[model samples]
Target: MAENPAYPVGLRLTGRKVVVLGGGQVAQRRLPALIAAGADILLVSPEATPSVEAMADAGEITWHRRPYAEGDLADAWYALIATGDTEANTRASAEAERHRVWCVRSDDADAATAWTPATGHSEGVTVAVLTTEARGRDPRHTAAIRDAVVEGLRDGTLVAPHHRTRTPGVALVGGGPGDPDLITVRGRRLLAEADVVIADRLGPRDLLAELPPHVEVIDAAKIPYGRFMAQEAINNALIEHAKQGKSVVRLKGGDPYVFGRGMEELNALAEAGIPCTVVPGISSSISVPGAAGIPVTHRGVAHEFTVVSGHVAPDDERSLVDWASLAKLTGTLVILMGVDKIGKIAETLVAHGKPADTPVALVQEGTTAAQRRVDATLATVGETVRTQEVKPPAVIVIGEVVGVGPRTSA
Candidate 1:
């Protein structure tokens, strides 16, 4: 294999013939991108998704309702085969190669001489994410990755047609813990100039409001202890947006480097031949407690603190938390999402020798205008949770340090 040339400019597929084989969802998905890239599309599929039907109704491309034929590859600039059968995709790939056309084999990238990178587009720029191992595990995974990139592009977090030369690109900006004002000055400045703002739900709406109306915004919000977007999707979105030469801001709650999955995105961008930078922000771990007038560390009461998530895997496996070690320590312990599992968490701490009456405070909606705080001992915290009906987006602090709250009420 040889090194692929850095995106060939004038060679873009404007007014070019592009043949897509397969009548399923993948073929349907590939059409719009090729169309937007100015390819004259011919979709060969026996069936199509509702989205495809809608596109065909709009007359965006020509549809041939049938299986692949030897003549399908004639006079085409590129081909994308997305069928259920690996054998069919392989056959289409071989024919395209024989005719010297670029092909993307939806099932097996190895079958094609070239592969499509996860891509993102903006005003004038087009960004793509290519892997050295294009023929690995599954092409669906590759397409799925590209889909996320497209979502960000559509929402405005990643822009394109950056300078012919590289410039400062993706910046991981912290959105602060649900309070737009708490965001750093640097974070706000970057967001204002951002071509795209890829944000998560934890990033407050107030912060999003800071961006001008025209600046693009994408919501990548993942609910804690519930359904979430896949990591690959998010990573690919970042790379694609940057490729378009737009200043992309990945707005995350708290600091991107801190437990924010920032490393995963950073690694993915580096692997795809794009460069990225990171910015830090205040974390909810300490800020939430402070908002409730509970100092994480005090001169006489607490010399240390610990922050842990109550995330448990789907298989009902044990948590990675060394509760025994944490239980014996003499520091403040802040647990995010420990509300539902407060009973279990309390049991583990007590069993590990932490006193049952250790002071614990549950801070709900911390840092927002509607913040609430409930103070209790470790033994009663779970029961108190049940009685008070405390919901998530809450933080739990357990230690003697919690007893030393400010005299005023939270």
Candidate 2:
């Protein structure tokens, strides 16, 4: 038996070969991360879910329209056997060993060479929560902590602690995904109470429609894809608003702490002797795709999921994404920038090991009235987008979950 290697922090697969021997939802769950990490994928199974077929057609992965066999793993580097049948997985594992490949048998976690973890990624940060012999999470407490964060978003109390006593309140809220309706009730109420609202260009505008006409609305005058108001200037504005006792709300999309830069703003307030609270909003990273009819988790598709940002800084050579390692994982990949870098991202995924034909969906303004979807594979996605025009404020989803959306004509 080969010893399991230690997992590195901030892992992603940029280039690698990973074979998933199953066609059901579970196997589908493993495709996204592998594609995101840049792994070439070969899916082997006699039967495949609609999602799997989509991936195959998109060229995100190569499909073997046959059952698992001893010869399938002839050149496999890392293998995942996720079929419902334990016997099949075991047989596949034996075949992988014969070819000197490391294997992870999903049916038997301990028997596999590696274990997948529940992950939350934002900005360039990734947090992996694992429950293993060496490290574990408290299921009971975990839910409570997660809820508290959600509650903060549901109510402006978390983002604007001083609002409780002041005449007007100030809240830095995250709106979550692209759906205007998904904003927490508290965030909604706070938006109503705002005498003045300073929103990011990306924040969904529909959510702001409910505001009173008398309440002044400012765009905060940010430059598109460019720096507008410096953080220092923005912090000063919040403090300025609070000193006047005007209810001020700083709105952001998705959970603020996750990558919305909520902490920096909060710190600025604190240093200025102003009190602030943070409310967590539903992260679009998971919710947008979910509302698009995709489940980040399914019985067989995946046991764990990871979230990452599509936008990386130009100068940062150190990618928070460990593409080589992520290529070996099994999870859904949700990217925030669906159009800007879809082609490069698809190419990177394919070069790594993800099948060039992996299924990919570009959901523009997901959960909104103007929502549009383009279904294609990693190989054809670039070409497909060229033929079809997709605007910004979109989410790019690649995985079995995408199969849940309306069918795309080949």
Candidate 3:
């Protein structure tokens, strides 16, 4: 800490004038937070980086498109003098001082009246860390401290017993393809705070191991065409736990709504008068194929990509997908939960006039260490899956895009 330690505070600049005297890297970095704070920004610079220009173009800020001129800080509540030009920055700093506006100088931290801290957010809490120039003003060190605090808060390792407000409800959290790290921060935070976690066989399974020993972890065990917990039973579990004043998290793979039967749970919870929060995850339909180096849609090669659930065979009366129409389309096709019925699906597509030579790739247990990709043509995919012993939770990608990038065949 310096002899004159800085007093930290958060400014609510909503609808207040904030003058930014440069559009360089520093200004580019600082403008977003100011904008998010709902500051009425005025940017003065002869030229700006493309990103800053985009903000101005989007009408988020007013860009003068000229060098910093005197009187620019006349009515500003705060000023950021970041124009790399030394003389211009000095002039602007002097003007800000005369106007008594809080100013941050990118060139000279000691000369500025205010300093920006390395800031991060977790749940509804904001973590900001500041260091003095005498302490070397290492932004990276400050950021590292900020990140550690935020991560601890999000993972429940850090807690304020007095500030804790537990809301008892069901949160439909999509754990993302298979990687624990891929889950959204909000989803992870909710899991950290959960008292009861009813999880599926899919999604980020590793996250379950991280939950506190006191948490009740129920295995929904929803395996396709296998021993599984009934949907109704799962709903009852969520309702029962939440009714007991416990925060329940229904952890599912991919997006809860993307064929995960999330709406059914929401409807059930609604009838039971329970609150539910849906946290969208990275769907295996797109991400799994991507993890295997397969793009769902490639420019000129594929104009569109369709995601379809193939749990039911194409010949099954219960099947709602139009196999014939799907076969006629020239875009890419991504099939989830179709490993067991891939043979019939391939046959139906070929019978409906899809090319037999269309490239196909199956990504199994994608985004995890056990992930593997097997490549084949549309005609050979059925047989390939059998010989390769591909399992459930595989994403089947079909079209020229499967062959677009460097192949990642197992």
Best by TM-score: 3
Query: Which tens-of-lDDT digit does each residue in 1-410 have in candidate 2?
Result: 33444464443445566788988977777777777777788898888999889989999999988878778787667788888888888888777777877776767765665665554433233445544342333545544654555554444334433335546546888877767778878677677667778787767687677666777776755513234456666777778877787778888877887767788888887787766656578887777666667677677776766666667621238557655554455667777754766777777776678777666777777776776777888788877777887778777777766675554321
- List lDDT for all candidates, in order: 0.77, 0.70, 0.89
Q: Estimate the TM-score for candidate 2.
A: 0.55
When summed lDDT is taken over every stretch of 10 residues in candidate 1, the lowest stretch is 1-10
How high a TM-score does candidate 3 get?
A: 0.79
Model 1 agreement with the true structure over 129-152: per-residue lDDT tens digits: 665564344556656777677655
Positional deviation of 289 in candidate 3, in angstroms? 1.5
Cα lDDT tens digits, model 3, 1-410, are 24688889999999999999989999899999999999999999999999999999999999999998888998999999898799999988988889899999888888888998999987677999999553468888899999999888876566433255667899999999999988988888888878889898896889999887888988886423234358877888889899998989999999999999999999999999999999898888888888889989889999999999999999999999999999999999999989999999999999999999998889999999899999988899999999999998799999999888986646
Lowest summed lDDT window (length 10), candidate 3: 221-230
lDDT of 3: 0.89
**Worst ten in a row by lDDT for model 2:** 154-163
TM-score for each predicted model, relative to the true structure: 0.56, 0.55, 0.79
What RMSD, rounded to one decimal, does every model reach? 18.9, 21.9, 4.5
